[model samples]
Target: MSTLSRVSNTMPTSLSCIDLTVTGALDAATVLGIRQESAKAATDGPILVLLDVAAVTTVGASGVVGLLEVLHLLRARGGDLRLFGSSAALEITRLQAHLGQVTRIYGTREEAVDGGLGPGRARHLAPGFRWHRLFPRRRRTLGWS
Candidate 1:
């Protein structure tokens, strides 16, 4: 079986993040593999698994469900899973009620490891936060095609 995590059986890498990248459709079988690998990696100690989903071609309910299961499994063991890649996929997937509330989706590896906008104030002050309506696209598409 291909090793999905932990290059060494030594101590240093035990508590570090395991980089696991996946491609193709984020389907049942793929998620199952992820879950199993994560389970194995977490067995030794609380581990941080950085999942790269940039190459993933499709998304479905099963993928999201399986992700949640893995997240729960890790957190329960005092570990965590931070996902970085395919902002669109990560954003949509993470936006699911519970997923968004629990996990984070970063656009880059640095953001995932070092950190990014996280645990912010409940109130958001985005462009249209206080007022209603989106910033008219006209503002950005004034002259350009």
Candidate 2:
């Protein structure tokens, strides 16, 4: 028997913090649940998402694939996804290595959020790409202070 737990909390910056606890097998059903929860949490367009997988005991290949898909969807919408905790987990480390620079892993939730895990963060952007070009109307439309 396996267990999957998901809890989501919204941050001050509208970043959704999802804490996932996976014990035993992680299947496609669990992944779907996670995706649905994330979608519910992000109702106002693209937004930064922080995943806390510290309590995950194991990750299956399908789970990894699902996570990658989620990451891609978020990034394509001008948003970003960051993973925190589980640094010592072999599955997480392997996934991080496989994903290379595409994935950002943090040691703590605060570090992940405070480290500029959102849009308009100069550090997160690629070289030669300006924030205005990516989000010209975000500040005006979103009233981002």
Candidate 3:
């Protein structure tokens, strides 16, 4: 039995995709392995690989970097990587990493499977939106005290 099981979905979408359920730590090696598997699948044609991480036991910076690498690799080959599932560790990593794969997360399998081509499309800000307002600027002043 494979640690990551295939999740077959029979839905019509613009993307040709494969759904895999992953368990345990989502480390770099695992992500790289997924990239290799995705490469095999891409032999048939371009595909969007979706990983279900609900059962992921743990996550760290390496995992985040791996995800970003895999994502870029797939996309470069006319494919993509999407992730869905509920795991506190994944959420924490996403927020803390603040790099890639954050917007790739979907709340539910349905949302992920049925989501549109654009990841985090709705999350994009409008033109001229002040980021400082949302993030708050750090204050600094010259003082001798």
Candidate 4:
């Protein structure tokens, strides 16, 4: 006689892509990696930096702040960083909503890779992929600061 045992587990997929992983902590090093990879992609044109934050057990304020900086840097350089499989989208959204135009959030890696930010359009490694701002800038006391 034999008895059957049921098992349940969660594991990340071993998918090969232009992807990066961050866990436990996100800091200057993470930003550096993003910069290096983005610079390389700038040369190639239309670089997609997919960060898998699904396993991020604890994302501190500083870490989230660093992530914002990295995202801004990529956008400034004509590249982009998209959050893939982010289980903590709520936290990220809250932290970045105030910053205005932070990282472009996506539900899946496929959506991010497909560049599905706009309506019924697919952007890839092609020309004319300019980063469009979702909101207009507001004039501040420093005169559009």
Candidate 5:
């Protein structure tokens, strides 16, 4: 497994951009490192986390779940997490399909940062809010009804 490196930059009071470049395989250890980096980047005030994952070569299910967890953490702290990478990245595309409403994805870092930092772009949900709450209930078919 290859290592993941994260570099963070704090923008004037409202945004903290984290560039994560991961090479080789993205495994549990690399995902943990990313979570730690995200925690370190979070602040007391409302902040946006723009993650640049353009350099990541391979990603696993664990990596995706880890990122979703990070996103939840940031949202709970009155912030949001946005991912930017090549549109061809299968892992990223899959994630976008599943969590697009809760998380934003962009094709380029500039686009991600711009969208993430834009006025009224970040959806600040209440702390401890669950993503499932955003969706309406589906009618029971057979078992639970």
Candidate 6:
């Protein structure tokens, strides 16, 4: 079985920023760890998983699928995953293997981090702050068939 390990730098305080350096095969086990780590970071603020795929020259279909699951899970939990330092050969292989669609591609770590974690912008759509257009229902659909 393959493994996905991360060494990260983050603010100790809750509601801050996190930067994780992902390495290895990035399989299901790795995906679970990443999800847990990201969720923990989200309690403070956005999390960034900076995947350094330079060493990972090849990835299997399961690995790619796991990555896609991780991306969507992080997004749903208000965190993100980004790729950095991937080789051209890897890029071509990723495309040829039809795994590119599963993950967002970025040229630089800075760009990925900047794009995912918004620099200094407030989270406007937080819980308990409902939009004016989405009105509350008068009658609740409680256990209706």
RMSD of 2: 11.1
Candidate 5 to truth, TM: 0.64
- Residues 1-145, candidate 5: write the lDDT tens digits: 6777666554443365567766665557777877777778775565566666666677677877787788788788877777777534545545444655556557666656676456666644423457677786887788763
Q: Is candidate 4 or candidate 6 better by TM-score?
A: 6
lDDT of each: 0.67, 0.62, 0.73, 0.54, 0.65, 0.59
Which stretches of model 3 miss by more than 4 angstroms? 100-102, 116-145
For model 6, how does the per-residue alpha-carbon lDDT over 1-145 read when each residue is reduced to its tens digit? Answer: 4445555553242324455554555556656666677666667655556666655644556666777776787677666677767666457656765555445455656555554355775323322344554786577788979
Colliding pairs, model 4: none
List, residue by residue over 2-90, the lDDT tens digit for candidate 4: 11111121322222125765554444555556566656656755555677656555545665677777677766766677775665643
Report the C-alpha lDDT of model 2 over 1-145, residue by residue, as the tens digit: 4566665654555544555555555557667776776666566667667766666666667877887787787777766677766634534545454754456566667667776444654445322345576577743556665
> Which digits, one per residue and each the tens of the lDDT, describe model 3 over residues 51-120?
8999888885777888888777788888777788888888777766764323557766656666633565
Ranked candidates (TM-score, high to low): 3, 1, 5, 2, 6, 4
Clashes of each: 0, 0, 0, 0, 0, 1
lDDT of 3: 0.73
Q: On a 0 to 1 TM-score scale, where does candidate 6 land against the true structure? A: 0.56
TM-score of each: 0.66, 0.62, 0.72, 0.54, 0.64, 0.56
Query: Which candidate number maximizes lDDT?
Result: 3
lDDT of 2 at 85: 69
**Residue-level lDDT tens digits of model 1 in 8-27:** 32223335667777776676
Top candidate (TM-score): 3
User: All candidates: CA RMSD in angstroms?
Assistant: 10.8, 11.1, 6.4, 11.8, 6.9, 9.7
Per-residue error for 56 in candidate 4, Å, reads: 1.0
Model 1 Cα shift for residue 19 (angstroms): 0.7
Q: Model 1 residue 6 lDDT?
A: 28
